[model samples]
Target: MSVINYGQLLQLAWPEIILTVAALIALAADLLFFRQSALRTRFLVAASIASIGCIAAIFKLLPGSSEGMLLGGVFLSNPATHLVQIALLVIAILTLFLSVDSTFTDHVGEFVLLILLATTGMMFLVASQDLLVIFISLELLSLSVYILAGFDKRSSRSAEAALKYFLFGGMSAAFMLFGFSLLYGFSNSTNLVQIASAIHAVPLNPLVILAIVTTVIGFGFKIAAAPFHFWAPDVYQGAPTPSAAFIASGSKVASFFIFFQVLVIGFAGAEGSATLHHFQSGWVPVIVTVAVASMLLGNLVAITQTSLRRLLAYSAVAHAGYMLLAYVAHSEQSLAALLYYVATYALATLGIFGILTVTEKQLGNDKISDLAGLSRRAPFLSACLFIFVLSLAGIPPLSGFFAKFLLFTAVLAVSPGSKLLIGLIIFAIGMSAVSLYYYLRVLKSAFVADPPADATPIQSPMLLQLVVGLLAAGVVALGCAPDLILNQILKVIHASGL
Candidate 1:
């Protein structure tokens, strides 16, 4: 925390700094140079700049480094953190590419700028261990996304989605902030490690219990867990497609990672237990209840959805539940498994939305039936959709399949004798089966059903198709070779002791 160490703050935060610079540059370029250009031209230029900035930040993270924590953990850099940040940037860059063809808003520069700003927030959110920094980063990301959701000013649905997102997000922030205040009051420190040390001395006091519930409630909303997921279906259906994609992909990665950190590191000794017939009073049980509710509700409701976006939104809630299983298990391996599951999940959802962007434009709606005979109209995209959905459904030799496999394996490894753990895993597996039915329903529309008599062939932008193709290939590559990313994640976790 010395002055010279403060000097290293810039070095530690170079990725976020680069992203901010990129955002400003994009804004300026759009205002000064492309003010009257065609909308496509503006989007092309802005996306190129934004993509370069993301690539630069990724390169900055490429070199190996010993872990560093500066500014009393307000800034942190390590291999594990870098990996997650890289994943976030990748998702952002893909989203940027996906947006190039969108006509939702003519403010091309502003759109790109907000994407970069949101990426910057996610980078900081995943890297920092300080509660204050985390809160600021969350708000930064949230505010940008709220605006982006309502970016299509011409649409009443867009405006409504943005309002609901903002209101719920504000309430969640307040809850999280109050929880942080309680933690700070108890520990007299804003640092997570310090807070953990303090709490270890008086594990699960009434105040700490309050803090845990409030904090979980706050994060639950972010991850779109059940009972707090009122905004997701609307946002998914109403927001600009690219905005929805970013919210589902990059934000999920950063939020879940930090949530894990707060619980496993900051609330270490208060895990209690979620074992069946041996339930304990702690955060674990709270997580277990949310997970169970999310799994059941998300899957069942998705079965009734006709709209693709709402179906995916409900599916996202179910996926959130599955990812929370990692929290319940709370093991080193579970962390790795969670990252893999969430990362692959993000890629799959991004591709789905990318396709939806094109299909919705071509068909004038995003209903499942609207995609009828997609295999005939846009064979390549239909194929990609097949891959993305099956991956999400956890089909074999696909990344989603492996992600669930590893996650379930990790949870079972912890207290295999615990009936509660076994039952939860069984329930998760059953829900995965239920998820397959709905996902297959999508495929049936695209492949098995016939299109309307007046239907025309769908034509998507080359850039959009390229982005979606890459996402699909990524899903396939990661699934066929699970170790490609998982090994690196494990190595980083082991090295960083995270």
Candidate 2:
């Protein structure tokens, strides 16, 4: 034996450790360097450098060593971890942009700490191979997000959002804990792989089904899938735009990854045949209903909204529906579609929200009509925003179209007998078509309408704009190079067998 040691675990978690250490370094740098508000641009540059360095640590895992690579079996660095970590890194960069103009310079160091802490929690959450560890990591992320969401303590809505989030989030967590207890009882194991094997070995009973349902609902709350989604709009509207962006991108995406991990690795092994044979019928309907509801609610409610920020809030909820289209699919094809969709969605959403935060400052709280004829004032800025909106609307050649198409095609492939799939496909197509109306409404206001006589087109910082460029390019590139992106998803899927 080559003396199994702690060093292996540390190596596995090097990226997360690097990020945490960087955050502390940034904090000390802020304290030491500041005679006045650390020069915004200079401080931001440093922070960006540190954040990128943190993400670079993730690159080490891309070559993926999967022989129980971390924590002597307590942790893992399998292909699933690789793909999810990549997603997490991309979202972290987006958060950097989202906060660049918000509080990065003034309270410069503190926001970075919060972001890193939250992200660290996410890293642990995804890497965890046991339910107990996953729960602990989840709380770490949740507590950090709860605070961040209400960082603007002066705002009543921010406070209210935090409270509402806590209540609902807490309730869901309780259900999750209870479900975990039931699962531990039934399967006699907390280790995800073993529990999954146990569940798969036996027919899924009422208790097992309850455990699964409650667990889904718990994660559902995190992801803003409907019924559990009531908190998202209020929270998004109330939270600082940057925090909202992180919450929207990082929190949901991380939860999605964990939800996926817990299910696939916990209960979806080969023995999963027995469990899946029973649960698929039950869960599919519920997922479809939530998905359809989210789409309609998001798009329909968004039309009447006057504020651009609020509209985007609803738009995020609707987009949640689109993302869920991948999950409702009970097959690997749908999952690969999901992987592609989320990757595209992550970059595009981050870019759009990053721009939103910047412009909100200049335009003074984005109202739809206020955006009248934006192209005339800042054609470039308007064009960038247009690209984002078009992507959101699923216009072809943009990443959004490809993501939607992949999801639809995947779902369609699984549609042979399930009437639910047929109905879902129709709903998905109709919803896609219906979304054009609201997205176009924004576009028309941008290009066709007249600019506000007083307001000028806002200019974005070069780095932030560069980030936007990267995301826009990513959106298109993902569409054009579907196989490349899909391949990573497939490998992860194969490893996890989701």
Candidate 3:
């Protein structure tokens, strides 16, 4: 191992450091203002501090052009890392905005602080190149989320959600750690590059395949892929809306990026080698099966949900399947497609959840019927929600359509002649069509159904309206000119030397 220098490490890790400092400052402020009668003012102060930290981190990340290993190969910093960090921070800021003046106001400072810490962990997770670093960062992210999920101590459902998530997360961590140990035993190193080099020197073994399967299963749960996705709907339904949004967006994005790194870096072998063939053949079938199952099951089950949050939770599972299609293609192009699709999905999802937060606060429930006549009560909110839901359903002239197009195009480009791939593609298309039924069901409730006699117009805060408007505009912009983002994605891919 190379000796590490603290100064250089701090420079490479400036974003995480800034985030940590911000979290600490928020914690101190929370303690100082715990007895303040004006809860809103306290929350705003904390949020402002967190936002400043995020801005500072973004500035630190934007200027760097160097790309190389950091801290003796435990972490990496490249264009891809920078992009993921920026996404995590942006999502964190949005989440903080959503929490303000909402149910989380009672503990707003802690809430924002936890989100900052979780975002920092996500940034580290994406940059990690060592098994130990990945595990530590994942734990940091997961622990903060577990608390955030149950932050509404007054709600039984929230408590139940946190408990279930904790249990499942613990199990997944064990599986992943064991898998990492197995890999280390084989390679005598925790670094991904070294593992790949070591694996290429030996014949394929059952243990190696087992490690791959175990690790993928662990990651499968994180991304809410099928068969391992039973916890998602329950958690999403019960958690605070902003917490659910963060889990669905920031956490999912980081998980997929790290999973991609583990597969492409740790298992890859020399060109034309038996080990490379073995790794590909071993994992491709597993991912394909997971993707197909996630799409079919998630979409089919979502149609029956009357609760808006549960319905979106199942929709998320289906989206996970769509993102996995990129991995099935297993190329740099596919990775770019996955990133673009997730970024678009995150924007739409956060917008919808932001609207839900306001609606839930006004009405005290998230039932599908609760959205009835939303257009009459809050036309702008209704319009934003419509755009987001339509985009999620992959309707034309929206970001979701282009995202799905890129994913399918990437996969088909690689495996055009494979009968299995063709069948899976058709199945995915059918499932996407099925998904439209449920998405439109929500829209119909919002736009066409009658409002209750007691219903009153919604009065959302200006900040939330601004956030939703920006996200909705983003979806439209991406749909109209996907190349704007795709070109940047291409640049990142090239910069990474992949």
Candidate 4:
């Protein structure tokens, strides 16, 4: 192992330091200008803008750089780190836009600060090569989210959701830590690189199996993967809409990065050196089982939901399942496609939820039945909703379709003979069909039903209207020209060597 170095640590932590400083400066401004809500709101918006600007700065700063492990191997600066940070930045920008007219009014400054902190933790998690770093970053992200979930302390439901989520999240975190302990015992190393080398240098033991199995369960809960996804629906339904959007997009992306990094990078053969490389077939069943059940449970349960928020919660779970199939393919095409899918999904989901938050404030309920005949009442909002739902359904000529199509084609190229692969593909096709029923159901209600005699016209903000416009255009643009994104994703895949 290389001796400890201070310079590399600074380089690795610069981005995170920038974000931390911004949050402190913004919070100080909030405290200094104590009595004026208008001034506070304006400054809060400015702080969010500055935070996003710093994210852009980091993007420009880190793309081609390589600073090895930092914080004694806790944080890192590498090409893959840059990719995950970019995704987090996108989600942060979306959250800022959504917060403008939402219920984050009373504590906007604090909320914005916490959002930046949550993102900072996520960045650390993606680059962490040590168990200590992973555990710290995980708790950092989770604590911020728990408070965000219960931000509306006045509401019992929100408080209840936060408590329940915290309990489950904390328990899973403990499990992960315990597994890491077992791994450390087996390998005599806490660093991922060292642990991997040790794994092959010695024999696999009971502690090794326990470490891998238990850690998967821990991360599965974090990503809301099947069997570990029980907390999602309730927490999502209870959190403030913008908070829900943040968790749905940011947490999922960040956690998935760490997940893939663990399986693909840590488990991969060493740099330019040959060993018994993985066959990958062993991972297929675990992923396939999660994918099938997530699709069946998330989609089927969503069909019975009257609450739009609850429906979206399940829909996100189903999407996770779909994305997992691409991972199972274990090819460059699939990896590239997964990144594109994540980017497009983040933008589309944030835009859709932005509108939902706006309309909920104007109409006060997120019930699908309450939204009956919304087309006549608010044509533009209804149209935007239709586009998003269509995209979610993987309808042709939308980004979602390309995302699913590329995944299927990639899987076919790699494992054409396996019955498991065949079954998964068929299940994907069937689930797509099953998904259409629920997706189009919302559209049919919007366009075909009659507006209530006493229904009121929804007044949405211009900013939200613009977000929807961009998302709708993006869905069509990405779908028609996936090659535009394919190149960027290809860079990411090659760099990660996944």
User: What's the C-alpha lDDT at position 9 in model 2?
Assistant: 74
Top lDDT hit: 1
lDDT of 4 at 38: 72
lDDT of 2 by residue, 423-454 (tens): 77788778878888888988898889877667
Whichever of 1 and 3 has more lDDT, that candidate is 1
**Model 2: residues with Cα > 4 Å off, grouped in runs:** 1-5, 39-46, 64-73, 103-105, 200-203, 269-281, 415-417, 495-498
TM-score of every candidate relative to the true structure: 0.98, 0.90, 0.95, 0.91
Point out the worst 10-residue segment of candidate 4 by lDDT: 267-276
Task: Report model 4's TM-score to 2 decimal places.
Answer: 0.91
Best-to-worst TM-score order: 1, 3, 4, 2
Total backbone collisions for each predicted model? 1, 2, 0, 0
Model 3, backbone clash pairs (residues 3+ apart or across chains), number: 0
Which 10-residue window of candidate 1 scores lowest in summed lDDT? Answer: 1-10
For candidate 3, lDDT tens digit of each residue in 232-260? 98899999888999998999989998898
Please identify which of the two predictions, 3 or 4, would achieve the higher lDDT against the true structure: 3
CA error at residue 68 for candidate 1, angstroms: 1.0
TM for candidate 2 is 0.90
lDDT of 4 by residue, 1-498 (tens): 566576777766777777777777666666566436674365446456546656654765466655565644577666667877877876786676667776544666687788888988888888787888888998999999998888876777788878888999988988888888876876677777676666543234546556666777788888787778888888888888878888888988888767766655444332111112433322344566677888888888888888878887888878888888776776787777777777777767776787778667777777777777889888898887887888888987888888888878877777677666677888878888988887887787788888789887878778768767877888789989988877877886676555
Please, what is the whole-model Cα lDDT of each candidate in the order they appear? 0.92, 0.74, 0.86, 0.75
RMSD of 1: 1.3
Count residue pairs with overlapping backbones in model 2: 2
What's the lDDT of the predicted structure labeled candidate 2? 0.74
